[model samples]
Target: MTTAPLISLTWTDHVTGRQGHLVIDRLVRGVSSGGLRMREGCTLDEVTGLARGMTMKEALHYDPRKRYIPLGGAKGGIDCDPRDPQAYGVLVRYLRAMRPYIERFWTTGEDLGLTQDIVDRAVAEAGLVSSVQAVYPLLDDEAAARRRLADAFAVEVDGIGLDELAGGCGVAESVLTALDRAGVSREGTRVAVQGFGTMGGATARFLARAGLKVVAVADVKGTIANPEGLDVEALLAARDAYGTVHRTALRAHDAELPAGAWLSADAEVLVPAAVSYAVDTANQARVTARWIVEAANMPVLPDAEDLLSARGITVLPDVVVNSATNAWWWWTLFGDIGADADEAFAHIRRSMRALVEQVLTRAERDGTSPRVAAHAVVADRLPVIAERLGWYA
Candidate 1:
């Protein structure tokens, strides 16, 4: 990472029992946060890279000139089949092991195979312990800690604002903002969303609500499309725990297509919300969308993004687009104790839209991708932020 990494530590993975890693790229208020991702190819290096993006995301949201919430960037990952029956216990143990760091340094929510339900279970235990320790020394009683823990979970696990949905909301915010900046109306604006999981499904539904046509949505099961737009709510009902919707879900209206069909869909916008590297060299040429808003981490490779930028495609970076929920996490924890899910969503939509617009303005004026422009913004603030946040001290 170009910026000095603050903390790098590994753990015995719950699912695989192999070595996995957690890294704190930066720290705000003596703490950091990000997602806990688990899949077949996950590695420490990948976690580090994701952590770096989290740092950039924090910088984007906590811009000193704007409404900011101080939060450092962090990420964690384990390599295993999270579908295994053993995953729950393993995840719980993982969190228990991370108890001290979580209390004092980092907190991870959900990502990839790690669902919000599982996240609730994993972090709930750690938060309880941390909350207990926080007040036990001074108050010398469990009542205060118990109350604190209850409040944190009330905001975190409540039905209205699941962490993954929050992420998807953020992605939708970026897409809407980018579209408005491009002078594209939401009415009849076709969107092809690849990877119809938590983030993708949420983005599709919100876009549909905003009068955009969700023409296509693809998951691991298959891709379903309708030029007139799919019924997002019905499709959502059919989605499985992992975000896949099979023939049973879209039974009558489904236009069964091959995998990766969303990439080539004739649409004004494309959102890659599932796997990383969806827009690599192999399929970069097939992405016909005028605006590519990366809803997933590292969805577009560097060279591929370069090619698209050269071809006049506006590529919004994942950090900026996916920053909403992270900011919400910090805000709910340290800024506003009474913030509800709707308020959090509205605030993030406003904040992220403004941030995306700023990046787009600078990028368009300077003939650079949104990512490069965003990096310049973060670079200018990093030195000062480092000093203030106790980096390299």
Candidate 2:
């Protein structure tokens, strides 16, 4: 309920001079959960907003009957390109600098340019027990929880890690739920996604599998588009760790356009699955899609959302769509779910669909945007959570 973060710390990297930031927006039961992202222009303000988003995400999935209790929200970000030679060292150093918080208050994994493997490596290098060790005290069986999460992370479907696919499954499910509500058909429905990293790639894969046409996918190099629907599998296979797609993997019919062409792609759904503040007011006018489902945090700027809403373009907020990955982690760790891929996907689909339907239905009733409706839901739940759990169980 506070406007400011509980704790905000900015550190200047000793070797590269890059700045890194940590924002603990709220803590419930003495712990907060979020992820650390590494990007070229990652700022303290961005991390602050993401931390608050995490708070909302944690609250949005709160279910008292479930074994997984939502932790508070916090986030970490470093202002450096993950591809830089010094990036890994910077990550290790940043982890080392924030070891105290990681050990005591924040439970973090991968976000944006970072991956879970990289985070684990950095955490070990920093001499920490685990990236999520902060919440161990709250677990009923710390060892079992640890093994459960580790096993879940190790399980892969169709050669992609389950951890990587969980968030995208949630995003795709949100889009499908919205379409189903509108009486739209999924078969041949067009989709354009920005960024082809773990989130975007997995989203494209699931949507394509569900009979949607992924016509465009944008990455650092540019956009790959095919009106007849792209080969999502091939492209996904060609991506690097940073999500850049290889040019050679493109088919003869696949057209390479400027990176920003994704906004103009002829599609019904546009998913900004990469960076924060991607769709701004200036470029929001280029969007022709009926829906913009955010798979990345804060992709649609507030001003852009207002304009898009006025134009009758629905924008699904990221807090609800992308909360699955974090929730999946806790659900597995806390025994609500197990280490099986089918069970994880099934749970993600059920929960995300229910959440999307709830938010959209509330928005229709309240005459508000989905973001506002989601915030209202969080507002109602936060107090209940605190009242019942006493803020620090």
Candidate 3:
């Protein structure tokens, strides 16, 4: 990967407190895009690394069958009290402050510590052009899923909106694809998801509904389990605002398991979508899941991934599992918008499943992990891709 260029911003406010070390990495065609994150423990390097990863995400997500609409990578972070009452106000100020840069050069959506409502309000407060109104700089005439979303962004400012639902669906598709490639049958595949938030919760529900037996789930507070299969929709409904299932709620259905119990659940698929670095070298051995889908970025680090690979665990990279959500190729192929909720999800499901199948097949043929194989394909084309778009000389 080429070295990334960086942009830095800083500010202090009496009402919202202090936030600094704002950064943007990897602008292409004088434009960049990624999610905005606000968290107390976030760091400058973390944000930079994430920004660079977005570039890799766009590049590695390439599919020969799909149009390669030019989109660059970038990420922003605000180190702040996510739970603070004033956080919302702070976010408004931050968005207002970022309007100048974003209006012409960047586009960001919700990520960690953010919500669709928050982004809408912030964009409204900033008096910037609505994302819907701004045409995607990429040149493509085909109707892709993202183009559908771009169109949706125009009309549905008040409706369900994008950010959308594909993250979970893509994850479920990746898990199922992995299971099939590994010769594991879906009917009896036990699954454990460490994170009951939107992504993880939706994934658990999707997988369970798809015939996989979901046996364990966790939130920050703790893990809950019932090998017989926890009631999916009930637990999802019982989750607190922060995705935590109260012990009282869990006791009624699943036995509240010990800390980190989700990692050891006798399952075939494990999705760590809650937080970064959830599975590292320290506990890679305790991980009993044969297949892992990284719904969250960098959930499994390099060293730990190596360990898992040696252990015969097939850990699909986030670039493959989480890649399709924002993949320009997908949006470009989506051809037209105005899709209802079911149509939207259905589109994503087909596209995601196809991508997963391709990646897994390539990994098998190349005799390498999906991460290595995917990156190998992307790295060769990076310079050519950049040069074609007049990004880097």
Candidate achieving the largest lDDT: 2
Query: What's the distance in Å from true for residue 136, model 2?
Result: 0.8
Local distance difference test, candidate 1: 0.76
Order of quality (TM-score): 2, 1, 3
What Cα-based lDDT does every candidate model obtain? Answer: 0.76, 0.95, 0.71
Weakest 10 consecutive residues of candidate 3 by summed lDDT: 155-164
Clashes of each: 0, 0, 11
Q: How many backbone clashes does candidate 3 have?
A: 11
Q: Write the per-residue lDDT of candidate 2 for residues 1-393, one digit (tens) a residue.
A: 558888999999878899999999999998999999999999999999999999999999999999999999999999999989999999999999999999999999999999999999999999999999999998999999999999998898989999999999999999999999999999999999999998999999999999999999999998999999999999989999889999999999999999999999999999999999999999999999999999999999999999999999999999999999899999999999999999999999999999999999999999999989999999999999899776755
Tens-digit lDDT track for model 3 on 161-229?
344455787788888877776677899689989888767877887798899998988887778889898
**lDDT score for residue 202 of model 3:** 74
Give me the displacement of residue 391 in model 3, in angstroms.
0.8
How are the candidates ranked when ordered by lDDT, highest leading? Answer: 2, 1, 3
TM-score of candidate 1 relative to the true fold = 0.88
Model 2 RMSD in Å is: 0.9
**Candidate 1, residue 124: lDDT:** 76
Error of 1 at 280 (Å): 0.8
